[model samples]
Target: MLNDIVKNLLKEVSGIAEIPANAAFNIRNNSKSEGRHSTENIDIVPKEGGSGLDIYVKPFTKNENVHIPALITQDGVSEVVYNDFHIGEGAEIEIIAGCGIHNCGCDDSVHEGIHRFFLGKNSKVVYIEKHIGEGDGSGKRIINPQTHVEAEENAYIEMDTVQLKGVDSTKRVSSAKLGPGATIVIKEKIMTHGHQTAETSFDVSLDGAGSSAKLISRSVARDFSRQLFRSKIIGNTDCYGHSECDAIIMDNGVVAAEPEIIANHVDASLVHEAAIGKIAGDQLVKLMTLGLTEKEAEAQIINGFLK
Candidate 1:
């Protein structure tokens, strides 16, 4: 009975716009309302709910500019997914995708979120994704975002992600890809506390000649929280790739970091680096001597590390 209602709602939502060609989308809901969770896969379509800012994407055309801004709100146990972004050639586009999840007065509830993108040759794309959790309670939420970028020669892509705190939350994964003569840059930052767990993964492949990829990641874990990061750079042709993951663990926290670089062709150049350690005790002591509280000094160290 509940499934019938959700199906009806989705049917109404689908009536808002036509699906793009060469695109595929899928979303599933395990449970709804105050129960398990709800998940959906939605293509970039016109606004139908009169929210004016729900989901928006402008296609790239010759000498034309495009901007996409989307805001998603989850009041309870719900999941949302976005898949397959179709970008045209020689065009420029920007996307700002954000979500706010408040799981107040709920327990054992869940949320899942995903995003994917595909780019054409000689195109430029800038993407920003932010995930935030608020309210004081013991509920669970997971966020997983994946990006598939097919940039033609001379294409450029830049991606940034930020994850903020909520009780018992997890950041499942994040990833991207790059084509030949294509350039990609990725930056990720995360913070967690209060028995939370965060995990992030990125994989970038350079398949075109002279293509380049770069990734930088920073994270902070406190209390009984934990974090894990994995970054991989693969160069299959005459390409170059570099990746780095740096993290700081504080106060009984745990962190595991893995960074890998692979070059399958003789002309390929790749580099990978990772660092996981606690805040410097001497620095903390010096800050404390400067009349800062211990907690404040710790926060300063973490902020500096991420910078």
Candidate 2:
């Protein structure tokens, strides 16, 4: 079953699913919420509706490399999880959250997650999330993720999201507000194939002096897949913001990259850049001449490009 597959993979990726754990983990198995455990200084409370979790970290606590895995496996099942996080001041933490979906039923399966984070002053938070979908079923496996972040003074927030393969469709949206001397960085990587489609939108506001944000996205569309990347960053104070979108399109695939920057203050600065193109023939030929097969060369190029 997908539960077993995902559990094993999660263990390999994050080291452990449970047992001797320091941080908390909540696993959603085919619309069913499973056990969750946490450390002493951390609080993990299940929401009233059983579809979400409320998490709080004590001030001055350092929680590093915390693994929280959520898995969804079932045909025709639709599961939604809401995670509300409040990180205390002077605390540094890392979170690993990934979703694996396996659908073998004729009906389409979907998972939509909403996550919100509140960063306290002088704190640093790193969040890593990965989504994977796989099955032999005729139905589509879909995942859509939405995130919101509010960073206080001197706070740092870094978000990494990756969608490797097998998802039929996705629409992702993320927004953040940065306070004075706060920094927010977002990195996204996605790959789509086989008639799939994906769209992503990011909105960021640097509202305080010395606040800054960077939004970067990399995607590959192949075999009739389509994708759209859009980001709009606004600087309202003496801040700096930048957004970049890059994509490699192949095999009749289509992609659109749109980046916009808005500066409201004279001292504020913003920059935007986007690029979408197919794989370079010369690069592929050179790799192939080095004793690599065409397919191997293509794979190597994509792996390096995404990395």
Candidate 3:
């Protein structure tokens, strides 16, 4: 039986529809099999150690986006997943995957997922993933994720990762390598509160001539929470790379922004910008003047910034 929390989480991380017959869905370590679509274009295999699930997409597959969202609703439950995807030559597709934890137990629950993508020549892919946790229990919620990407010649990839709320701690590391004429854009968003901690690091390399990379990251922290944002972009040959980081902090929270740009060749173009500060008092006051309580006004401000 699905709890209200898990159901709402699925709706946010994935979509609020019936699980497609051809979709690969998993919870904890179990994969739904009944009426599930089993297409030759994609592969979902069990890890040898019964730890998680592995996903792969074959060449020339233009199928719809796959929803592979997992949930941890019980305390004392820990989950791990390692997903591998291969987008074949000239293929274009979208992938949506995420994890949500609703803990009501006395012990901490944790989720760690590692994902890798291999993009074939001239292919394009869009990927979106989000994480969230909710509950009033004494148990803690933690999420750690790592992502690696390799783009072939002329390939293009866009990735969006989000952490909405309720995660007590998290550390994310992401890196990508691009080939000639390839391009990649990454957008990451994070929010932390109530003594939580969140850290993210990104490393992107435009290794081939004419390759390009761009990274945009935004974060918010409040109520004594801590956050670390780091981005490193490397440009080789005649490639170009750019990175930007923006953050908002409140209530004695600690926020750190570190952006690095590396140019290995004289023709390489690399640049970066970073800004971290607390929420503007005027923004909060303006919202409160619209007949909202101070708390409600703050919430609206944060939501608008994240949106």
Candidate topping lDDT:
2
Which pairs clash (backbone N, Cα, C closer than 3 Å) in model 2?
none
**Can you write out model 1's per-residue Cα lDDT over 95-198, one digit (the tens) per residue?**
54444444455554454545555677787878776665554555555555555666777888888777756636665565556666889998888888878888
Instruction: Give the poorly placed runs of model 2, Cα more than 4 Å off.
Output: 1-3, 12-20
Those runs of model 1 whose alpha carbons end farther than 4 Å from true positions after fitting are 1-76
> Each model's C-alpha lDDT?
0.62, 0.85, 0.81
User: lDDT tens digits, residues 1-307, model 2?
Assistant: 2356666655643456443344566666666666667777678888888778888877787855555566656788887889888999988988777677777778898888899999999989999988888778998888898999999999999999998898899999999999999999999999999999999999999998999998889999999999999898999999999888889999989999878888889989998888899889999999999999999999999999889
In candidate 3 the C-alpha lDDT for residue 43 amounts to 70
> Candidate 2 at residue 41, lDDT?
67
Q: TM-score: which is higher, 2 or 3?
A: 2
The numbered model that scores best in TM-score is 2
Q: Model 1, residue 103: displacement in angstroms? A: 1.2
Q: List model 3 lDDT by residue over 8-119, tens digit each.
A: 7778777754456655555441232222343677777766775655666676778556666767777877766777787889877888877778888889988888888889
| Alpha carbon deviation, residue 34, candidate 3 (Å) | 9.2
Residue 246 lDDT, candidate 3, scale 0-100? 86
Give Cα distance to truth, residue 231, candidate 2, Å. 0.3
